[model samples]
Target: MNFIRRLRVPRLNDKGKWVVCVTGGVLTCGFAYALEHTADASDFVVHPFQLPWSHGGLIDSLDMASVRRGYEVYKQVCAACHSMQYIRYRHFVNNFMSEDEAKAEAAESEVDFIDDKGVPAKRPGLLNDFLPSPYPNKKAAEAANNGAEPPDLSLMGWARDDGDNYVFHLLTGYGFDPPEGVLCEEGKAYNPYFPNGSVLAMPQQLFDEGIEYKDGTPATMSQQAKDVVTYLRWACEQWHDKRKQYAIKVYFGNFQFRTPPSFFLTQIMKKWSDFSFFLNYTLLPHGIQSVKKDYLF
Candidate 1:
């Protein structure tokens, strides 16, 4: 009778073990299914690209003429509200124009500073003086704008994925919506490219009669947008050159057979041919297949 009881107890324990295993398996499968479905759903949702130079977008090449026009607009109109602090008077002479032109332009503006020799010198250019801060700081600027401070225009061109186009649209795209409940603040307006579909700070700042251009280009909204975009682009290009030079050098040196001696030309050609074949046959198709399956799953 004791032996029978022990056998019955063992059977009971085995059944319990089986039950626990089944339950754990079911829970694990359910969790995995939920996670997979969530991941799949995310692929359908499009997130806006945030980088300055996102892939697969149209970008205009740098145009010196447009940039010159932009400098004029910035000097005449935007200079009052915005400041290009990172740029220097010497930069204009070195990078954009002749020294004589730079000097003449500098003479037209007022900038005073103390020299290293403890002597006060007044430079006749905007670059000599730091553009006065629009507000004490970010907090103050935000307070003035009803909690939305206008961003600095220094790198504004490269801050968005569509760079120049984004600047252009932001400058020109201002209007009202018919749904009267739209909460556009007193000085704010609507912009389509912006995620909020409304901007809180900038109203139509540019108009045909707002400023006079020496080039006789009509001071239309489009022209102003183009000018400002060009200026911002130039600023970004300047910054990018400083930061990306090393990476660019490495890329060209490694890939273009620029590093190896002349005797290795044949070997380099062979290596390139092998790499091309591998890329075309194995890598490219495999990548396409993986991407397709990932989306499908």
Candidate 2:
């Protein structure tokens, strides 16, 4: 009780020491936050939306139906510009489609091949063929699209932060006119969702009813965005579902191996106790300093 009273009334000389400690702590925190906030953070604007496959950071794996729809979206719309250079038709066969269906899909396209006579010839795409690029080479691709090289999208979903969301927004967020003072070039389209608001070379891709959905799904802007993003996600990581399953098993296995039932019960309690003591030791002085600042100020 006496000690509590004494603490409530610190010696007058100690007040300056308390103020110095509190001021130093606040200045340290402020400096840390300032250091963390950087110019690149401006480019990280993400428009929030919900999707059927992901909810609140819990990804339910890519739905096969959505993947199929997204593939169609890519074929009909995105394939004209971007290429899925790393993907093969065989992936579809292994994951989503039957062998016959994959063959049929591949057959619709053609690939360049060397004939027995050592002459170049084009042949119908095969199950093992890479998804063909829109142009034969970088210069040709650039020439067709006003000197801009559309990125290969096989790994696009994994390439950027929130890549799924970024693709969706960039695809669908184009029709609006630029805000005042924003100048869109003559050929380029304005998309606020794009990192450069007015200078993106790729024009708007998704429009209402732009492509007929074979599955009878409505081809609205948002629907197309969802389907195409789903496809890109799958294209980028075909093993996403398998990876999750593997991860789950690995997590449990590690836990079991690390913690024999009898030892875990004892260790976890001690771990928590140590953690709590460390946390209080680290925070309690700062917390007291904060209260002193509030009261004294």
Candidate 3:
């Protein structure tokens, strides 16, 4: 009762009421106009959502099996257009495949170079040779793909926010048709998860049983996407597994460091910790076939 008495409500006389009515009308109109012109984020384009780390972390290393499988997928499917020019055949040696195996893999692809005679010649790829692109040049790539050059995959994993999730979703997000009022161009395919746009030149690539896995892992679309994303991430940051291992050692090892504790230890430890944290993003518990996959549609 005392609190209510402390509040003084102003009374509106005839003139005051008229002024109030006008003010309210103006405010209502302004609010309506603002709302009418306001941009809607969710309504415009769907953003990439983070996916949980399914593999073990902390003690466990990067899933080499997944990386190998992803390499296979890239070789058989994505290599048709996409390139990994920054990667070398030797990168596979001691990382996933054996030296002989890497050499054999390198031997499969041919590399072009100029010989001492100054004549342009081609030879079988070597361990030191960089990975090949499908096109001889950007112009050729563009011409082949209707002026859209297929991007190199070497650095794509680190190029965007939530890149792993982005790539994964993009590979799997092609099933949905464009929503009403959305005009997808004839050549471009509709993918809601595409950044800032609903349509992309890249069409649906991964499909069920598209490639057989040597390890007997079923080649579901989601699984292929997951594997390829893993490989891409490894290509982007080859030190990921080693970085985690060293961090664990620095954190729990007996040796004492002279440098400040938090700066080095804390920062490195965060990347490959017990789980969740990475190159610095907290992954939520979104499973393989979770709400995120269907959220945009």
Candidate 4:
């Protein structure tokens, strides 16, 4: 008991130092952990009355005609203010449309000239050129609008978890009452999804009066909203298709090698057959399987 007590007591130089250090470290860690947990929880909490449809998955299938019409709306109304700098004219022609059609469209939208150095300046297409900035740059735009610059729409469809629907809602959802004393800015209206119950900086820009459609479709506000939403959804599905195709190819390439080593190939085949049956019975109801063939050829 004497020896144990001697060991338990700290030496004169070390008394209370180790205990203080350990207690401080534990408290600091607990505070840090709590802060991290609070931030994570805040990220997941949906704003009041933000609908699920605002995220993508409302439309059942791709509508090519609607996407084309949406492109027309984007060119006529949105292109002046926003730019899709990353995409090239060649990409549209080679991937989405015929070369001749793309060239004609490009020629209609672009102008060529000579530079001061007498070098030929080829403006092949508006799609190939960056949109001229409304302000000198991002900093100027921010200064003009209380630090809110209009975001690029090109990848907006793919950036958010439910990007397509969120955009659709934003375009249509404007002018709602806020609580007393919570004043909205000029041309801005209350939106539940925005950080505060305030409003977005960009005013509602799309309406039937804004553009004339040659297709004889009603140029209603809802129609324009639906068209732009379709365009964004098409962009999303275009990338999605590439990924799905790659996955199918990889699965097929590895299919033959998954067989077990044995003289009885019958047993190996039987196991695979059972797996297929199980998959069809279980996964088919959930709509998880994308491929039609049970076995890869």
Candidate 5:
């Protein structure tokens, strides 16, 4: 026979629970407010990217056409100022072009490398050569660009606070009339999305039909921004899609073996309560009966 105990659970009154919740909420809000206000304040509005493969999508793969177009746009416009120091011609060969095609593409750009004679010489780029920098060195680049060297675009997609959208906004957020009372510093252009008081060295880069898209896509301002942003995103993490796939597979494969803590706690409570009731009611009752019988005898 199974014996059940009438277990009494102490419950918090509605008012007490409400006070606890309110106190917790107030503390949380205080902490969050402190954290938020601790940083410098600026009117930096982040824009979202118009992408189909963002966050959650069935085919979270890169748009290769956009990538290719972005590369062309970078070559024609951004390459003059910025250098992608991390990227090599082989990256294109492996992902976008064949070896012969990559070689042809590289051959168009002259790169300095050490020849077999151990002397640095200028030669047509090979399939393995890094992208040629627009300036010979940093000092020259800075001198040319008014003491500010243009940053590399290789990781621009991930390096900024807004990730990929930062690049997109910077490319397109130019030409807006500066707000009254806000003076752009000397030699700096006004861009509201720029974190430091809307002052930027780079002027508006993309314009409508600025460059001819070899793929025949219309080169609107927004179109160029999106394509270049896509390429930059790819540059930041070329294997992001593959990494996501691996993560999904690994998570699901091990999900079934994991036990939820709440369920485990409930099971332990049930077993403990059953054993407590049995010890108190069943064992104590028999012991009391035996003591009474022995006294009577």
Candidate 6:
């Protein structure tokens, strides 16, 4: 019943296999040829350190509890300056909060719209209402932050390079004094992990005991940073795990998709006598050349 079952890839012949092999070789060569000869990072900037994220693996899913905690952190802390223009209050339903909680959350916020008289009016937020911005306009945002506007956070995660890792480090990287030869303006602070190690206008936002958690999790600086990063990751891709689940279902549907050595591999019943088509190159065979369980087990 799956769409992948309906996918009808023509049985490949020798000529077709050669074309695929040659095209793959050409693409591989072109990719290697385009490699940049550059340093690991910009001068004065520290490379983002990889953190062990619970949702980072290919098969792993988001930590909903962390996401809930992260929303709390953002509401109490980052929401003061930044705006999540793309996220709606109703997005929380069945994601981390229940429908009732989402409705309650929306009810707490007021939305601006035009009234029947064509006058501006305020109303309680709905599920479709976008999260409110901290400032009325870009100019106001910049003015309040000393001419630097806070960026919208809806696409912050999964949008930047090393997105989640970079954010986690930046939040906890503050409070360290500048190294030798570093200069900061009167109101700026240095964070080696961001802005190319430049002095930025934003100050340390997370601190120990800054806020209490509803779940009674410790309110440490690192804990807050990790939770917020996890939350932002979910905000970036709510259907991330759903996509993985779809792929898994494809293999379980239709006829037997595997051989002795291959798990979930769709092969042409023939063996070394004919070519085998797989994700790319064939790694296992069903006949004499069939791979051992190491290829499946």
Clashing pairs in 5: none
- Runs of candidate 3 exceeding 4 Å displacement: 1-44, 55-60, 253-297
Per-model C-alpha RMSD: 14.7, 15.6, 18.9, 12.9, 13.4, 17.3
The digit string of per-residue lDDT tens for model 5 on 1-297 reads 233456657799999899999999999999999878654345443345554434336447777788889998999999999999888888886676778888899999987678899998988888777888898899999898768889988999878876666777777888877787667777778887777667778888899999999879999998998888888888888886788788788787667455476578989999988866766687667775564345336
Q: After TM-score superposition, what is the CA distance of residue 99 in candidate 2 from its true location, in Å?
A: 0.8
Give model 5 RMSD, 1 decimal: 13.4
**Compared with the true structure, what per-residue lDDT tens digits does model 6 show for residues 1-297?**
699899997899999999999999999987766653223224567878887898877678998999999999999999999999889988999999999999898888999999999999999989889988899999999998868898899989977899999999899988777777678877788998876545788999999989999999999999999999989988888898998787678766533544443642334345423433441255544343445334334
- The best candidate by lDDT is 6
Give the Cα RMSD of candidate 2. Answer: 15.6
Candidate 1 lDDT by residue in tens digits, 102-210 = 7677677666578899898966565454444456577877776667766666777667777766667666665646234445567666655554434446566777757
| Model 1 TM-score, 2 decimals | 0.56
Off by over 4 Å in 1: 1-61, 111-147, 178-181, 239-297
Write down the TM-score for model 6: 0.72
Judging by TM-score against the true structure, name the best candidate: 6
Alpha-carbon shift of residue 278 in model 1 (angstroms): 26
Model 4 Cα lDDT, one tens digit per residue, 1-297 = 888777865554465778888899999999999999777545522433344332233323455667767777877877756666555555555444578866667666545569889997856555455433345578876776656877667687777666666676667766556656556777565654555344567666787667877677887887887787777666545655456567777776667565444436888789989978877887777886664354443
lDDT of 6 at 242: 94
Q: What is candidate 3's lDDT per residue for 1-297, written digit by digit as tens?
A: 999989999888999999989999999999988777554324746776767755435665678999999999999899999999899999999888999999999999888889999999989989999988898899999887767898899999878777888888788888787888667887788888875457778888899999999999999999999999889988988888788888888876635564567567877777547433421243344434344335324
Better model by lDDT: candidate 2 vs candidate 4: 2
Reference-based lDDT, each prediction: 0.64, 0.80, 0.83, 0.64, 0.80, 0.84
Q: RMSD (Cα, Å) of candidate 6?
A: 17.3
TM-score: the better of candidates 1 and 5: 5
Each model's total of backbone clashes = 1, 0, 0, 0, 0, 0
Tens-place lDDT digits, model 2, residues 70-167: 89989988899989989999999867799999999999998988999999999999999999989989999999888899999999988976788777
The alpha-carbon deviation from the true structure for residue 215 of candidate 1, after best TM-score superposition, in angstroms, is 2.2
